[model samples]
Target: MKEFLSFIKKEFRHIFRDRRTILIVLVMPIVQIILFGFAVSTEVHDARVDVVGDLADPSVRQTVARIDQNPYLHVTAVLGSVAEVAERFRAGKSDVAVCFERNFDERLRHYDKAFIRILGDGSDPNTAQMIVNYVNGVLSTVQSELSASEGTQTASFPHVQYMYNPAVRSSYNFVPGVMGLILMLVCSMMTAISIVREKESGTLELLLVSPIRPVGVIVSKAIPYLALSLINLVTILLLARFVLGVPLRGSLFLLAVMSVLFILASLGIGLLISVVSATQKTALLISGMGLTMPTMIFSGIIFPCESMPVILQYVSDIIPAKWYIIMVKKIMIEGVGFSYIYPEFIILLVMTLFLLVVSVRLFKRRL
Candidate 1:
């Protein structure tokens, strides 16, 4: 019993003394708790809604006011035509577009019913569904108020239309998320492990001493993984298109370019991890556990960034996967052109450059 107690104490000391062990065992849990506590939510909040057409009508104004007042919905725009609304949706500005009939109040007063269209961004099926349901609730509230005040029931029923994905397939949202997660993990994990394995085996030190420059060494290490990730990208695209039946709505060439940029960015992350990690186990832990949780949570894979708190939303911006996922959704599902996606493309480009510069600078010739 005394010997066993001594062994246990030694084990405890080993765990606490090793900074990597302490970080993985103690700090990761706290980060995950903070992310999940603030980031995860099934309910949509502050959904951006655009009210199009007859905003001058009293009843229409009342309905729009009620929609803005709803905790889950915020009326962001009052537009003249659905053509403008379509532009907004394609630009990824509006979530739900509520189109009221021309001279809506007149139609309501005279005909006892009027047409209203609820347009939602179907790239995100869950939020689209929730926004439509909430819009319906608000419309229903308006009808009840009308009946109570005028002693006559209104027969207006709001028509719902989902853009990009009329069927509102859950796969549309999930496929892009899966793509981001896979590329991020595989590129980062493989690159980090490959470099760290060389480091552990003493080969990296030998290579560092060779006539080849450090940049050459880094490029050689990255080239194989980059090619593999490209092949992996193609495989995922084919599977997503043919096997899963997800539509490829935009230019394939553009998608390929964007995907390559994302892969490079992920590879940069792996390089960054390799610089800080001394061994294979440490590299694996940092790349796998550290990258995976943040990519999944902050990348808005399973949750909407707009629904999270302001600070979390800002944090989501730093995750490369978030921007990639957004670009993928717009290109693959929404069919938006380059003008709509350039911002995300630029962001990934900047991140790749930044990570590579920092990684190379931190990388030393000395082991």
Candidate 2:
């Protein structure tokens, strides 16, 4: 009993001595709870609504006003043509577009039947469905109000159209998320472990000082992982396309290029982790436990960022996976071109450069 108590006391001291272990044990759970609690909501909050129709129509303006008044929806744009809906979507201007045909009020009055087209991006089918439901509820309220005011029993019919994912397949949303997670696992976690193993064996410094060039050493370590990650990417694409039946709508070349950029960014993260970590176990904890949750929650992978709180949405911005996943969804699901995705592409590129440069500088400074 005395020996057992002595060992327990020593174990407790050991655990409390490492600040990182304490942080992983204590702080990580708190952070996870807060993030998951606030960020995992499925209900669409303040969904961007663009009204595209004849602005002169009183009924059109009234409907817009009502949509704006809704607590969950905001009318962001009043466009003159339906052709602008896709442009707004590409520009990230709207979550849902409310389109009224020409002479909406006239048709509603005479024919007692007018159609309000509801357009939503379907890459994330769950959010798309939620947005449609919210918009439909608002439109139904407007339709009832208009009918009562005009002494007519007929209401404007809402026709919902989902872009990119007309079939509303959950796989459309799942594949990109899994892709981001897999690349992070391969490029970030594996690379971190590989470099930390060398550090643990005390061989990393010998190699660094052996005139191989530290940058070259880092690159050499990363190259094998990069090739393996690309192979994984190919496997994922094949599985997604043939086995799961997810469409590869955009340029396959473009997808590959974007994926390479993302992989490089992930490798940089791993390099940074290895630079800080003193042991292989530390590297695994930081690279594996540290990154996986944020990637899932903040990357818009399992949850839509738009539905999250403002601060949480901002948090998602710094995560590389978020941009990569967005670009992937746009390319794969929407079949959008380079012009539509240049912003995300540029963000990922800057992140890759920044991470690599910072990691290299830090590695040199530390070791």
Candidate 3:
């Protein structure tokens, strides 16, 4: 009991001595949650739209006002002709174009027929669809008003078809990406730091001086972490399946196999980090900033890769997490098989082999 108490006191000293680890442990999760929740959004907002055609009609002007007043959309350009709207859209000045037909008021009152074309720039299909929906809703309200004034009952409403996010619930897409990020974070970053922590405290030397081969030592370090990470993977899968209602459309066996392969890759990276880092603080710092942060940003874990700058997009190709995220997304959401995701799988395998080979070579050099 006395020895246990003394050991506990020594552990306390080790923890308190490293202010960096303490701060990271306390602040990292809070920062991640806040950053992910408030800043990362799948919903489009303040999308710019161009209103074209007859500005003289009061109904048309009202429609424009309604669109402009919407917080999600802004009528930034008012053009005279459809050609101008198309030109602006091609120039990337507008996400959507709202065109009011000629003789709009006369057509609505006399014929019970009105036409408006919502031309979209199809570059970002999701935002284009949303803007089109807003335009359609506005047109419906105006049509209803005209029918009410005429004492006529209307039957038909405008049709809206989403292009990219057809289902419109982004959680379907986000869950798999979230799983990839969690795996990378828990498996790669945590294992790296944990193993490096053992090294920093001199226990690694004692273990190495024993009968344990380097490979055995590495495997032993990874085994418990791999188990813990698999448990975490199961929890995340359950949350995604039951809690979030994301269907596992593809083979569960394939996802599990890929997950295990990914775990091995992650363990390789963690072991490499352990071998490189002389101290626990350095390992945590390198893993947190070098591995985790870039994975979060570049893996399409939160922000859409299509939305990122071209340079950043190119840089993202190198991140192993990006490939894993793509693999998971293809498997879970698109219901794709190994044949489709094989290229990315190959890339991941290649990266894992490369990291492991380099780490082994470096370990030999250090010895």
Top candidate, metric TM-score: 3
Q: Indicate the worst ten consecutive residues by lDDT in candidate 1.
A: 29-38
Candidate 3 collision pairs: none
Alpha-carbon deviation at 271 in model 3, angstroms: 1.8
Highest lDDT: which candidate? 2
How many clashes does each candidate structure show, in the order listed?
0, 0, 0
Instruction: Name the better of 1 and 2 by lDDT.
Output: 2
Candidate 3 per-residue C-alpha lDDT over 223-326 given as tens digits, one digit per residue, 9 for 90 to 100: 65566567666766776677656678788888988888787788778777877788878887888888878887898876788899999999998888898888
Give the poorly placed runs of model 2, Cα more than 4 Å off.
1-153, 365-367
| Tens-digit lDDT track of model 1 for 1-367 | 4533453454346445767644544444334333333344345778899999777789899999999999879999999888897789889988999999988888778888788999988888877988889888888888788768878766655555789877555567777877787778767876787678778989888878876667766776676556656766776677678866789999898888888899889888998999999999999899878998988888877778999999999989999999999999999998889999999989889998899888888777777
lDDT of 2 at 313: 96
Give lDDT tens digits, candidate 2, residues 65-139. 988999889988888788888888888778889889889999989999888899998867878888888888888
TM for every model, in the order presented, reads 0.61, 0.60, 0.65
